[model samples]
Target: NLRFNKVVICTDADVDGYQIRTLVLTMLYRLTPTLINKGYVYIAESPLYEINTKNKTYFAYTEPEKTDILRRIDGEKYTIQRSKGLGENDPEMMWLTTMSPESRRLIKVLPTDAERTAEVFDLLLGDNLQGRKDHIAEHGAEYLDDLDVS
Candidate 1:
């Protein structure tokens, strides 16, 4: 853990991407709370789609951005490419959008509600099978299948 001063979690901008993130956070929160308390843990924001309009290139992080851009511009003239994950992005694209300090966004990990965060993490990642099942049921069907572990 001392090899690097900080840990920036880089994941896909997809459901499964966050699942992996949660698993890692669980480990960090439990085993290395110091990393989080000291603001050494971070989450990198990777845009979900890169939109190439006739005039300019745009990156959309959420559906609303894409919708807004489409409405503002002629949707027919732009190309939207879904980002599968970090692996699919070219090295330059990756550096510009995610790794670079000038344009990239990183959310530092800091638990505002430590008790609640710990409780929820335990409920989701703990050995409580019934709790996990109930939590899954409460979230609905896609919570189980929509995660992009691949």
Candidate 2:
């Protein structure tokens, strides 16, 4: 396996982005759990909106942040730009605001609760997790050991 010091997941700042990010994290959690356990996995935090007044520019991550920024400025005077996806951002803007080392935001993915995370992934994978849990409780490790070895 190719070993990397870090894995950064960059997605748009929206519901779809969140879903895609979750799927990626789940895959990594199962396939390369050490990546998370070693604090090498991260999610890039891109802004949902960029608000620019005549004097200043602000990046907003949520609706409330946008609202608060607008409330502080003259709505008619300032221009508010919402990012639909990462592609919508210009390279300079994306780099300076989302990718630059000095000001960029990143959320490290750590396996604080591996068991719960595994359970959640099982649920996401659908139906089988509950059955597996029930089966384990009823039959115990002895039953699992009895399965035929290939």
Candidate 3:
């Protein structure tokens, strides 16, 4: 009997955070897929940027969202900064943006397309080196911005 009905995975909005999320999700899918299949697993969406004006602070989880926020606040003087990691965030901001059930955003991990999900996971993380190489060769350009060349 599990004590919690929902299991939420929270991480930063960066490359390392993405890797960590992938590894943990892969582990969970491999070890206890029931959690995912039962709709109990979720990923907490963290903001990538925090936009602050004189009176309001807005958190944007994606680049498009940041752009939208900026456009909405046009003509207003504001400072936009990359959001710090979970540990580095102040307690109030952390709670408001991530921990609060009312305000937080969550993506439910569903295996609705089980075969495709499995194939992609195997191609990227399994022992299919050639397949992984081929995939990157074919689709790498779509994710070039995500690569951390720095």
Candidate 4:
């Protein structure tokens, strides 16, 4: 048996990536919840933007960070592009942005209350179809702006 310290979930910084991450977490929460309870699960945050300058490259994970990066550059010529998925990124970029412990940002998966966590999982992913619908009906309005209707 192979021993491991942490189970990191790394995906693209996009909608599809968020869906995949949720599914993986649901599987883990259902099959081996101990990993989460014991603090062995983590989510590796991927950068949303890649800002390339004449001499350097900066990875920004959030809009504010990207703004800050641009502010720092202060009129310096730079090209900003949306970061690609992990599968598309080069080995060096992946290593620098994700695999390297020093540079990577890991959000620990800590479920403080097992009961509440289980309820949420069951309501959303379990066989409770009605519950999921009801939740969407109640909370979906808050996320309407996030929808990609186009």
Candidate 5:
């Protein structure tokens, strides 16, 4: 019995992250679509913001960007907040990072390819463990990253 008024999925910005988010969205769409129709589910954009200044904040999209930001902000005192995962944060942080409309980025849930999406959800989150394992084994290698291991 899911009583959530809004389901905010804050996953990483990688392939696995995308797959997980898709699976959850699919389950909700199948089981309780009213919530989705009412604009309840959201995909929270986990920040890649590294160098935050008083004037403007920057999000590092890649290692090169991170290096560039560091170089640009050299000798300037700025707060660096390294957010590893959403689980490391508390409810307040979650609200601030993912829930707040003013400060957070949320993507509306929309069904693109319903049939393929249904099959994906079934393979990923269904009762069959072997199906889940095989699915991951086949597609997971593409998204495997060292930073995503946590």
Candidate 6:
């Protein structure tokens, strides 16, 4: 057994990513609420931007936000960078964006209706292929962009 000081879930900002994150959070909350309450788990803010400044650093979630933040800062002395994914960053950056509690963003898991959650989990991860297919087909249109046809 490994002793973990914290558990950080890093996922993409897509529907699939959201679903995976939700599933994990649900599992953790149900299985180990103490860990959650103790602040042992976090959801890393996958940087939408990698901004550098002389006095302060920032991570913006949108291009307009990045522009706004940049404008508010001393542009002459600051450098702005954008990160497409966590993989683009090095170990230190990853640690700064995800591992460091002070600088990172943590998403708390909330309790949900057990019956609905069970039904959803079963439909998504169950052994029944047709059930999964039907569930996907029903809600698939809304999240088509998340699917990789290839």
Candidate 4 residue pairs that clash: none
Please give the lDDT score at residue 94 for candidate 1: 94
* Ranking of models by lDDT: 4, 3, 1, 2, 5, 6
Off by over 4 Å in 4: 113-118
lDDT of 6 at 70: 76
Quote the lDDT for 23 in model 4.
Answer: 75
Instruction: For residues 1-150, write the lDDT of model 6, one tens digit per residue.
Output: 329876777886545666777787778766876766666776765767868776677887667978888788843577766565666668887788776768777664334433355567877887989999988888889977657778
Each candidate structure's TM-score, on Cα atoms with residue i matched to residue i, is 0.79, 0.73, 0.90, 0.88, 0.54, 0.57
Between candidates 2 and 5, name the one with more favorable lDDT. 2
Which pairs of residues collide in candidate 5?
A: none
Task: Give residue 39's lDDT in candidate 3 (0 to 100).
Answer: 87
The TM-score between candidate 3 and the true structure equals 0.90
Clashes of each: 1, 0, 0, 0, 0, 0
- TM-score for candidate 1: 0.79
* lDDT, candidate 3, 52-132, per-residue tens: 999999999998999999999999999999999998999999899999999999999996633355567788978989999
Give the backbone clash total of model 1: 1
- Model 2 sits at a Cα RMSD from the real structure of 11.1
Candidate 1 Cα errors over 4 Å, as ranges: 1-5, 113-118, 137-150
After best superposition, candidate 3 residue 110: deviation in angstroms? 0.6
Tens-place lDDT digits, model 1, residues 48-150:
8888877788888888988887788864588888976899889999998999989998887886533356778799878999989998888767656655467
Q: Model 5 lDDT vs. the true structure?
A: 0.72
RMSD of 4: 2.2
Q: Scored by CA lDDT, what does every candidate get?
A: 0.82, 0.78, 0.88, 0.88, 0.72, 0.71
The number of the candidate with the highest lDDT is: 4
Higher-ranked by lDDT: 2 or 6:
2
